[model samples]
Target: MEFNNNIPIYIQVIEKIKQEIVTGKLKPGEKMPSSRDYGNNLGINFNTVARVYKEMEMEELLFTRRGLGTFVTESEDRIGQLRYEMAKKQIENFIFNMKQIGYTKKDMIKFIETENYLEGDE
Candidate 1:
């Protein structure tokens, strides 16, 4: 709920929801809080929460039932895909940062192997 001046609030909300889903805090098929309530809890505008929910629905991460509420998607495959995508993004960011610091692919590989090999040597 803390908004960063550097990033769009709606995007931050979307990420929070995705993290909850990936962490099992928000289980599949669980009903999400109504936009109004969530906004109040976060001290943000209802419209912003509505935008977050709508964008998530578009991503197939959530679905809304008529006269009911939005719920997390019930597809295990979708959840797995989300996890993979998130991990891939994290790895990509790590690689980019390492490259920015003048690390080559060879250096990264060597570092990984050295650190992991010693730990597993026993």
Candidate 2:
């Protein structure tokens, strides 16, 4: 929950919530905390929490009940799509970095196949 100075706080908060949803830390149809409570918990403005919820709703990652509060989306297809979208962005970044370091597509594939990446290399 530490804020990155380089990134806007609301964007970081949005990313964190998205990650939680994608990872099942926030279950589908689970009620989200009230904006006031969430803002208090994060030490952010309530308006910021409201903005986050609004953006998420527009993205279909969340939906609000008439008076029951906001909940995570119950669509498995959307969740799967989110997972793929997140992974694809990561892979794009990895490839871009690798290319900048003089790596080829073949080299990247070979590195992946050879490295025991599943085991923590620490």
Candidate 3:
């Protein structure tokens, strides 16, 4: 995990884990690595990883089962909400860039519905 100097490392780690969760890379109820182990693997301080776990727990994204370790929360609604938020952000950025280059709303919609756009994406 490469840390960006401009952003807080803990926040970056949280975003990465959130992306993993929303993308289904980390399934609901999946067990996560122990803070110490994860810190060692990432070569960061264990306390920082512990902070991440605590923040996640506070957000109800993860739950700790005492000695059993922490596991991802089984929240389908949360996952759906996250997916929606991510898609909305991407679409907003795409629209902003398109409009900057003189594309109208209709043009954007037409392009999105056309085979040319699909082929360009491919």
Candidate 4:
């Protein structure tokens, strides 16, 4: 849960929580750590964790039970879909940037091949 100085802290926190949920570390309907607990665990401010939770709630990825605690939503597929969409958007942006930099379709294909190989190695 090391915070990146380049990205917004809350967004990073959101990604961490989302990663946990997607990886089955936090299962459907499982209670998440409280804001205070998360903050302590990550050495971040409680308000930052709170904001991340609030954003997740808006996205329907989490729900808070009055006094019980926030829990990962039961619709795990929705979270998966959201992650897919986000990754798609990022890749689209990368392609657009490459095009802007005058990369040809062949070059793009080669780059993708290299990326696939690298990813496979991982």
In terms of TM-score, which candidate is strongest?
2
Candidates 2 and 4: which is better by TM-score? 2
Clashing pairs in 3: none
For model 3, residues 13-109, the per-residue Cα lDDT tens digits are 8888989999899999999999999899888999999999999999888899998999988999977887788789989999999999999999998
Candidate 3 TM-score over all chains jointly: 0.79
lDDT by residue (4-122, candidate 1, tens digit) is 98999999999999999998999999999999999999999999999999999999999999899999999989988999999999999989999999999999889978778567567
For candidate 1, the lDDT comes to: 0.93
In model 2, which runs have C-alpha deviations exceeding 4 angstroms? Answer: 118-122
Off by over 4 Å in 1: 113-122
Clashing pairs in 2: none
Instruction: Give the lowest summed-lDDT range of ten residues in model 1.
Output: 113-122
Rank candidates, lDDT, best first.
Answer: 2, 1, 3, 4
Q: Each model's C-alpha lDDT?
A: 0.93, 0.93, 0.90, 0.88
Give the higher-lDDT candidate: 2 or 4: 2
User: What is the number of backbone collisions in each predicted candidate, taken in the order shown?
Assistant: 0, 0, 0, 0
How far is 73's C-alpha from truth in model 1 (Å)? 0.4
